[model samples]
Target chain A: MSATESPASTPLLAVNNIEVIYDHVILVLKGVSLAVPEGGIVALLGANGAGKTTTLKAVSNLLGAERGDVTKGAIHFRGERVDQLTPAELVRRGVVQVMEGRHCFAHLSIEENLLTGAYTQALSRSELRDALERVYHYFPRLKERRASQAGYTSGGEQQMCAIGRAIMARPAMILLDEPSMGLAPQIVEQIFEIVKDLNVRERISFLLAEQNTMVALRYADFGYILENGRVVMEGSAQALGSNEDVKEFYLGLASEGRKSFRDARSYRRRKRWLA
Target chain B: MELIFFFEVLVGGLLAGIMYSLVALGFVLIYKASGVFNFAQGAMVFFAALAFVSFQSWGWPFPLALLAALATMIVVALATERVVLRKLVNQPPITLFMATIGLTFVLEGLAQLIFGTDVHRLELGIPDDPLEIQGMLISTFDLIAAGVAALLVVALGVFFQYTRVGRALRAVADDHQAALSIGIPLQHIWAIVWAVAGFVALVAGLLWGARLGVQFALTLVALKALPVLILGGFTSVPGAIVGGLIIGASEKLAEVYVGPFVGGGIENWFAYVLALGFLLVRPEGLFGERHIDRV
Candidate 1:
């Protein structure tokens, strides 16, 4: 997997043979394996407590601090072993995570929050100032409110700030945990649109862990369904979106009514709901 | 008996206040980086004075003795970081505070064990002649001490504001995890802050030692820092200096004017009383930002 992630078609991140145990007794992730190809958004779909956040933490190597031990397994990013590295080291290497909650330094100005994103990058003062100007281009709302303290921002703005902070690292890949967890539908759409834009324009890979299966699967190129700490299903986003079992369980469609719709042959053929 | 005598007392008090600020800066540096209220800071001052005196009396030139004393303080800071503080890094703040209290005892015993309990005079290499400025009779030593204190404060400010390490220290103060995530090494920053704190303590020791010879009594002067820290915010550099000046002046004046009303020893409680009054008005201190944590 590491060797195949070439400059042309490298999987941005590959998680293989990973196991996470809490306190040596209770196991959270049991040998979860997944790969996110470059220039694609892959959603790790699961319900609450399905270890989606843990999987993201394991990939970022941030679980060791919380007694969530990655007992075995390796995470490779841009064809380099990244499993044992600390979060600080990972940030430097460009595998930044936005985390579950926004976790912006609330007391800091919006500008300071962004500067912290480029914390590991030793850029000249003029270069840092220029990079900050570029960040404001993506999230213009943030630019308008740059001098304001982060705590005063709305939840949606805070989420934007969080993503902007990760972008400041100029990461090749980003792990987003519950980016739309508590946002309103309108805000969720806005955040997802920004994510899509980032993926399409910047060519940055994204591995998003989300409970909102409908919204996540809609935008993702590939999808992995995690249940009870294991990958119960993996396929291209289109295939998983139309699978019978996925429709019944993930999309919350009543099994009795959409029995035929469950086995969608193609996105165009599944037109009953569209009509 | 008149207003002229009161003016004299006021001037002396102000000089004392500046000295107190120098001592308080040591606590501020250590606390900002490590979040540990260092009880050993006072002991560090005493030890620094002892080193200075030992070097001068041992036939070293004045400049050489000063350098040797500073080097000793640095060694002490490094040793404290490697031995005592390294072990207590992740411990709770209370536990770390207690460890510092233990450090105070160890340092006191070590100083006594090495230098003995006898008092030693400290000559700051300045002329003992008095200078008359606008009819105020000022000792050259007091003026020099105050000047040294001002210069050190400015140097520390520059070191923290302009240097890479200084920015790293500020990041640590803001959020340790965030700082670490950015690869600002915690252990390295801790060692640097302690070394700088040790340097400040040595300067403070030299000044105080000149006023009252290097003895065990010098260690007790560290108690004066508590008020400075309380009145000035613990994390604030300028606050510490300002708080120290306020406490130093008021206490000296209180000991003279107010002490007559109530027996004597008003200096012993005057600083505390001032701090208590400040706390009642603003518990976060004069310059401390209001810090409220959410559950």
Candidate 2:
């Protein structure tokens, strides 16, 4: 199918062969492609410096803020071209990106932070209230501490606040960047559970970028492994989980279930991805 | 007689502080929303007062002149946002500060050219005679100024707490990018904030001009308000009021008691000395948020 036209089964969001460059000369993402199906969760898995954030920013059209641009590519939301829209316009069309850091307004109370998320919707008073209630339902801790300044909240609560604020947008899809960063393992599990619940129950789609490869693979329907601004591997969660190469490099697993430290250091056989 | 003299001077100083608070409130409003420490605020006060006096002298009624002056402020706000701030959106704080400094000179020159360099006596017809309350005299003008400042503060507080735009302002203050990501137009918010600061300048100018004629020196009063911002934290509304009160009251009391010892100019630097000392102990000022370092 053409870039503009998609059949009924086409994904909710598709990033087609996008190349992003920063400050005119520094190329960040080289022809990255990903698709997020309707009401489905997808993971862009990468370690540090893997252009995961660049890819997410490319899709959300937030690269402009950093003087970055998509030199060549098309981003489609619901099969409609959205490469030209500003970040605010993209938000109004129900696509919101939660920035990597839990960038809650440290001065604003948690409730105020959530209220700002619902700002563009122009919802009636009751609708605004309902949206707040929906976010509170997902994050009961946020509701309890709604009046406290976001800066005073714990790392986990701040993460919840960031996600809750995105939820308040009542978005059809969310571009969540590193939800697991700076959170405890249990907190990460709880957050992923919430993402799963939102996808299954509310039918809200998610495009999550995570460095926690195992956790991402655990929850995401499909996964893409990004390395040096390129997608090296893409498959279903189960297939990737069982893939031998993925096991050795990403999952910290060798054929014998785990690699000893000395063996890992000595066994640098030059993986195909590096080549 | 001695007790009454002290009491009279004390009340007068408190009233004068309210005018300073009014000017500082203008600075606080813009700084809170856009993080720009607007040096042009004092000049805007001068401009607003000049515009008002000019409008009235041009055969306009008092209320009509007031509306025209306010309209001018709003226009200046929109223009500043479009011409200056738009180009300097992601600029460093120092750049924005320097821009406002440049804006200060431009406004002063414009006010002089447009409204004439001559000082004009502003008589608003409000009774200025001192009233004797139990043998203590209090000027009616001071009382009126106090009442008006209080009213505006309360009204601004209520508006900020209840209005939708007000909530957006708080959000913008929180994080500009976050605010933009959530669909709040940063430019529109900055424009609205500047316009509100302009409104504050009008009220400050009108009253100060009435007390001390509409002239170039009228802008100097805003300079006196800098210590108020220092004491109250540039981000706090009530901090301006309370800081003004402290500055106003302490200066008068010190001038009375310590003027002879210091050769009678203690009021000139009393507020600044106090602010400097207070800030030394607590850098954030009375109402400013304590810095929280994030990892």
Candidate 3:
């Protein structure tokens, strides 16, 4: 089914042509839209300042906190119009976001940081313990350093903690932003493996905003490429991964071979999709 | 004999320091959760005390009066969150601080307008009689107040460390945007913190009212908490306690030991002087989190 027609199936989350403006003047997102199917991983691929984070924040209803407002369009989660709901209300409805840069509570222990995710759940003691064990099962490194302050943990561990913390919320969907940012390639691959595992086992959907296009396209079921606050191109992961333009512009691969810095700088000005 | 006298002064100062911690605790709660240095905390103390006394004067029973006053503080907290803070989300911290300074005046004015300016003596049935222990005298009222403060500190400590809501509060304190994205309701957390701060204000109000009478001057006691916050770190509960104790003991000791040479009344300014010196040495305070930027 086409992206437009998929909304009739009531996908997990649907962002319909939303426009976001910050400070009521600076327009950040213009007529951007995407959908994450239930139990599917969708990648929001873009360079920096391409409105990937803004789109995720729009779906999570977190833009308001940063003086950004959705000036137009609607966001539906599980067929309910949730554009106006508070972020906590959205979480209660099983939508949580792992913000970029591993925003772990520095002073709190890893366990405490995870527990904060379950704040709205009101789980019993045993249930809470079960949730922690479940998260630890996926990220054993977190289990080993559960008592340590999150600030002192390594970059990869903090990323795991951020995702683990979201898992503790028992969310139906998680808006994962920049999970691969600043992490080594091996660590990024490991995180994607756990994310795929969680998707398969727990049936959790993910709308991931990632600048690491090559790795994200490898794992995501579908992908949308955003540029200058607009979706320029979108397709199944296989299609986007193999597309020549995507390989040239994003992965630095050309018809001949890997492009040098001079050729790559000129490649952006020759984006056929923008034309 | 001299040693015995010094111990008495030290003990007295320590107990009085607990009172300062009580008021400072309210400031810490609001500051930690919202990053707003609530200048209105002093006014909240005065307002709660005045409300309690006013309710009692209306022929309500003591427990009933206390409950009503507690409810009033909760209302004040909710209103403040809804009206003032809800409008100022994402504003700079200085803007919020300035708003609270405006709030302080409004609360003080409202308290006077509602409860009248009359100074009413609050009798909590705790006698002010001195109890002697090995030739050193201690006030029974001070002992009971210190005990109450200790109980409060323990209860607050448990609430913060052991509860789900407590974890959310700390998370929000660390980062607002992240907390919100994770579905920790920023508004609810702010309201809860303010309500808890209001509750702390009530306890402090009642105790200070009984000791010094419920009057306009009771608002000035919040100034004493300033030195306590400076010493303990504005974000740490134990810091408030230790800060208060040091400020209390040294000030009293300074008044007694150094008063003859300096012509007395050094007790009032000694805490500030010490806090200033402390600021130069450790600006973050003893328990305040040291901010380290990783570049």
Candidate 4:
């Protein structure tokens, strides 16, 4: 893992002090910043409505579709500013996003869904087949259910198909939002393992938003915790996982003896980071 | 002799249904891509046919006039995507539908202003004279028009199934945000779909104009597509064809067999009644995809 990490040079992607507003009125993200090193797996940890998804969408320029705009600061990919680029332009520059809730093309078959991901690439027939083979190599389950409709597939398979579709784009960096949403624990493990394999083997970088702090820190090299559209805490994964505040608040590991409901309620109100 | 006459009406009505299918095809193409029920399709048909005739009156040949009319429709399509739809992205479906309604009036008024409201005769050179086949009479023009519609449907099917743009179109139809995230330019896709829909409108316009003089009434022919769409499903290409045939054949058959008792002119309302009944039972139509949400 250390060999894969470069020494504080230009990171693969950098989100610097950015703010997001939706519908030209409601503010969603406020002065959040983070970075993903080359060939690294970085996690954005936050509860629902914490702006993790917004940050990822801001990087991919998908915020525009939802009437959200990155109004402040800038995003840089490989030392070049890219916050103004369209989503398709961003994809052409090798950044793709797998949306939350596995937005698979429901009417299409699994293989067709995967093929749609390669729309930006103009590959020959043999090259297209080779790309499909590469994706299937990473996700053998996708191969087994290639003929089935994506909507009919299990949650885990749909999630895999979503990731497999992203892989078909051959992206340098992927913005993954909540890969473990509504899936079994074992399935989450399997997916994280595949994500790790892709990171190491394909040298692809990941900026994943996750609510599962313990599971995310177990796999991610670095993590950032967001609260109410703000980056409240960020650190190395080990430091965050072992930190007393994170362990107590995010991981549900209170250092004191077992407490009543009132004590737990008061404990949340007294978040140390906010203080 | 009675049986032979019956076969003639059946075949003629079926061919006429193909014309309705042509108009419905335009609606389906735009709806599938952008989820907009384009009410302006009728006006487009009127506009294209009028443009073609007006161009021909200025001494352009048949092929040149046709090309010029097609170009006009393409321009209209591109302009609509840019001026109207681009600004309305992610809007509710009803809002888009209302916008198309506004577009209908704009197209109708603009076409009349440019081409004048006087009805013009359009002759495609396909003679409407009856031809005897297997001891039954059929109009050659209807036969030719049906053949053209069949060819267009086949070409569209191949385009949607085999091309990258077609795959991207389906993806866009399924989910716009997801399609964008995967790098499919929503604007480009919208422009392409509207252009294709425009092309379809042009073809329908030319054929219908040739059948029933290039007049403002040509726009009413799009109303005939409404029944076809209700019976065939709004999203399926094949559904349009099949629904058109059923509506066509059944209405003619009802006019011949059931009209005398009802004092005639049942043909216009027969399709609507059938469509209404179909809505009660199989609202999705034969090939329309039924959305099954897993709670």
Candidate 5:
């Protein structure tokens, strides 16, 4: 089936014909377009320097820092134009980016770092107390180490803290950039499980950028293939899994050496004519 | 012969400590709000006091002079933020520190150019009569200074704890990026911090100027605040007060008793020595969080 007309047809976010240039000269993302359905996990798979992370950043309006300029096209969130809004304003609208490298404030305590996630919420002191309790429910390990400084936590713990901090904002969607980068295979599995749980339970959409194709397809219901800053192919997870061409190129399994079931048909036709 | 005198010195030291806390409070406010060390604090104090003196000299009532002086300090603060600090934002912290030092020189030059480089008496509005409290003689000015400092502390505490804007300021102190993400107007919060810092400096200036004639020497009192910040922790409000009191009282006692043996100037190094000892004991200062790192 065509990617646009699957069971997940309703586009919660639409990136319409976007072009991003760097420093008014270098063209990084060349006219890329994609859509994410509500409560759906969309995986954008690409090699390094394919503008995958840049596309995610563009959606969050966090491109200016990396010298990325959206020269053309726009990103629509919840049927509203969101490309013009600043990153902070976009965050208020429930679009949170769990940036790569797990940026947690090292000097602050874990509890303090979590509180910072609710920076935009105008909750009462009692309500904030309740929210804190809710966060501890999801991350009991953090609760145990709440008073401890964030720097003392392990990499996996820091990643958890980063995710928990983003969740504290009560985001409707989270753009996870390389969530499993530099993690152990065991830890990666656990992290992906948590991501799925968050999506299923909280109904939060996820746009994940990852290099692990098999792992991504294992969890993602739908996926997009990005090549050289463009969406080359997109389809349901199962169709893309079985596509012969996709296997040859992306799945690292080539059909070039395999014989086609065609020469036998010609030989039978010739024998029938002789009879 | 010496015991009675020692008790007298001790009482005097405690009172002086309270006064030092008042001055240190100004440093704490600015440092916490903007992360600017604000070396120009002493100049703000001098200018505020000078303005008050000028108003009083013009035959204005004491309350009128105080009100006018406060108004002037606010204006100065607004101007400083707009002209100097606003321009310096996003610069390196060291660059900003250097800018403040330059500001100190400019303000001193301006004060000298305008008010002349000489001492002028600042008449304390309170009656200049001494009061006897438990066989100790307390000058009315000391009582008034202490009372005013207490009021300042309480009011600041209320503002920080209860007000929305004050909470935003605290958030800014804790994390600037997070504060901006929350839509806290960075410029407005910074301006407010400066205004509050100016107000604190004015109070300290007036009290110190009244105690020892309005002159550049009153600016020197800001030096004592450094040790208070060091001992109390750079970011703690209560630490500033406690640090100040320790510095003030110990310096008073040291000058009184250890002066003969050390050939005087014990007051100059008393706060530093105390700070050194405190650092040796608790490197993070009294109220600062203990820093830890993971491998």
Candidate 6:
């Protein structure tokens, strides 16, 4: 835990002073640390190659697959050290990552895809049946296309299947990697709404990684801005949305008082350092 | 009399096809789970029969020899997983395929060294007398082999279609990373699949050795399953069976009717020619999934 963190309430998931190196040489993430508070959505906002996906993968311990390792840092899940756990063990502990590009099992039927998600749960027959029903309930479109092969589903439906499959695991925290990539605006909105609903109803915490700053800030309770492998700024969503520097740089709204995106951001950076 | 001879040949070819399918089933099981082509599978069949016969010659009873063969196959599976497959996980399919080729040499040499290079016969207590039904001439040995192969295929099909481990195996087959992300222990799955493949190889070996003596040449017979695999598919068990049956029948027919027309012994070339022709039209084989690339 960080020295500055509050003692009143511990975050459900926390990462401290993490450094990640890929292929034993190239560094990708430097001193990155963040937390997902219990039952809250924490958005890591960044553009491509900003290390947002790396951070999420580090948390889920999937970095091993890409020859990336957390060289220095500690990860704690539910206040217990989990930096060493395998991805499967992490899922059994109620943490799962729905990978980027919506990695649906294309050969399996949509329903079969969802059932595969419950592999670790060891649910009874009746319970498994109920879980499938619940997934269908969350995404009625899934039920309509449940028997259809996942590969044939639309991009929107595949994304829903990905999330619905994650949901079937009954995860306490979902490290969702880029939920809004390559989707229509309306579909993105629908997915965000469902995520918010799931958060409210199921009390499942989320650490969402996304490039869409405005939309992520719209739904997230707290946000962190990543730029070039570093956390450039961090604030509550409302505060960040209202901040003049963030508006010009990320929100794409030029504040009359601020000079330009680059100048205003650096100025704020300097100010932050000075303080 | 000619028609009766034709039907007799047809049934005999089918039984031979079933045996080929039996060997291919072992290949399919390992391929489905690990995406490894498992070139060592044919070597395994040769090794299994050789070991079983060796144990029997050492004065062990039939049951003891059978158990010892099963145990040897299990050890081979486990060792292969640890020493070979596990080390090469996430490698390109070609690299894994090449590794299995290396494994084939190692197993074949080991089998020859331990069990000696001489040929040996396997007696499964099944009498080889022809069981004639009216005007039909059916070899009782062929009938027993067909019956055993059918039962084994059904047992495997039901196991994969209905059980939890079967679902996990399919999950691993569908996508390895997705299976891992969903909390499936991929290493355990691979181990289990190799074990299943070993068992299937043993059954294939026993039946084949019962008919033809257990020799280094049995490895060549094991290679014959590849054409059957091509005709059916590497991923589908039923496809293996059907491919086996078709190749079996076609080869027998080719050897009988066509062989007289064009020198004798067309059996060797016939099945492969059929597989090659199938490849030209339906490249993925009959039941294999068509390769689809998503942009």
Q: Model 2 over residues A1-275: C-alpha lDDT tens digits?
A: 23233222588998888899998999888888778888778899977988999988887777877789999978999889998888878888889999898789898889988988987877888998999999999999999999998998998999999989988887898899999989899999999999899888889998899989899999988888888788877888889889987888787878887877776655543443363
lDDT of 5 by residue, A1-275 (tens): 23255445668888887998987898888888888889989898877887888898899876764567899988888889999887778878988888776766666677777776776677778877787787777778789989877778877777778788788778889888888888898888888888888889888899999887777877888888777777777787787777775665556564675434475457435643553
Candidate number with greatest DockQ: 4
Q: Which pairs in model 1 have colliding backbones?
A: A5-A10
lDDT of 2 by residue, B170-270 (tens): 88887887887777788888999999999999999999999899999988988898999999889999999988988998999999899999799999989
C-alpha lDDT of residue A273 in model 2:
35
Q: What lDDT score goes with residue B110 in model 2?
A: 90
Per-chain TM-score of chain A in candidate 5 equals 0.86
Please state the interface RMSD for every predicted structure, separated by commas.
3.2, 1.3, 1.1, 0.7, 4.1, 1.4
- State the local distance difference test value for candidate 3: 0.92
Deviation from truth (RMSD, Å), model 6: 2.8
**Reference-based TM-score, model 2:** 0.94
**Residue-level lDDT tens digits of model 6 in A22-103:** 9899999988878888899999987799899999999988888778999998999988999899888999999999889888
Instruction: Please identify which of the two predictions, 5 or 6, would achieve the higher lDDT against the true structure.
Output: 6
Residue-level lDDT of model 4, residues B1-295, one tens digit each, is 9999899899989998998999999999998888899999999999999999999999999999999999999899899999999999989999999999999999999999999999999988888899999889898998999999999999999998888999999999988998999999999999999989999999999999998999999889999999999999999999999999999999999999999999999998999999999999999987887894756
* Candidate 4 chain B worst ten-residue window by lDDT: B286-295
User: What value does DockQ give for candidate 3?
Assistant: 0.78
In candidate 3, stretches whose alpha carbon ends up further than 4 angstroms from where it belongs are A5-10, A258-267, A270-275, B292-295
* Candidate 4 residue spans exceeding 4 A from truth: A1-7, A272-275
Full-model lDDT for every candidate: 0.82, 0.87, 0.92, 0.91, 0.78, 0.87
lDDT by residue (A147-207, candidate 4, tens digit) is 9999899999999999999888889999999999999999999999999999999999999
Off by over 4 Å in 2: A1-9, A256-275
